[model samples]
Target: MKKLGITLLVATLFVSCSLSKVEKSARKTVDGNWQLNSVTYDEKGVFNTHLLNDVTATCFENSQWFFRSNNSTGTYNILDSDCSTGVRNFRWAANEIGKDSGVFDFTLKFTDDKKKDIEKNTGYRMNLKYLDDNHMQITQTIQFEGKPFNINMNFTRTTL
Candidate 1:
């Protein structure tokens, strides 16, 4: 009876530790779904931006990101930051109406939103900050019609 009880306790502890590690790894932005929390957009160490309050959530499955944001929802083929893949591809409906789909490729890029907005903009850059499993900050440099613009978008997980 004593030996059986001890064995059960040991197995329980092992499982608990393993779960904790997995949870930590999942919280990382590169691995799983992360929601934007807050951002402060700046250029040359100064702030000059215009953006509405927005939130975004991204999920990685089968090497693609099922991305959803304010006024946009689509599937994005994402490339990792390691550059193992050349670029990410995505197809989204045009204008959120008429149910038309278009394709775009984001090359030399990184982020959970890469493939979503790849075309037209030549130099789009972003960085993601993970606050927890449910919170993140996404900073974006949006070039409008080949002009420079800055934006900071925040999002929180719906589950959270």
Candidate 2:
């Protein structure tokens, strides 16, 4: 019984370390500047909606983003003349759901420039659906009329 207990402990430790490494590698890939190229949905039709409970979906298009994986912090700016333009800071994390699964539970929280959390009890959780050196996608699912609605935010890596 003691040997079995020790074996389980060792296994758990190994998994924990492995997951940490996986998450770090994924975050490294996301470090840099990106552009929110477009916003799409899973279903069809003209559905006007707000994203992140703060801005309309159209307002996010072409937004500029900067990420610092080393510190788990980032900022995005809305550039459209028709929308409010400013820098919004946030802390983000990419957590691998499985070993080498390439799927992650990405989370973002609003913060101040000093990295202090601004939304004390609210944050956004989304799926890191796809990621690569040049392109990435995040999906946020919300309920609409008692059904799941997916909001897909596509991004492209950029410089400057």
**lDDT (10s digit) by residue, model 1, range 16-117:** 554233233332322333333344454555443332211121212123333432323333333434324332333322111112221111112222444444
TM-score of 2: 0.87
- Weakest lDDT window of 10 consecutive positions for candidate 1: 94-103
Clashes in model 2: which pairs?
Answer: none
Query: TM-scores for all candidates?
Result: 0.28, 0.87
lDDT of 2 by residue, 1-160 (tens): 9999999999999886654666887798899999999999999988888888778889999999998998899999999989988889999989988667878999999999899999799999999999888999999999999999999999999997
Clashing pairs in 1: 36-155, 37-136, 37-155
Error of 2 at 156 (Å): 0.4
lDDT of each: 0.38, 0.91
- For model 2, the superposed segments whose C-alpha errors exceed 4 Å read 1-19
Which model scores highest in lDDT?
2
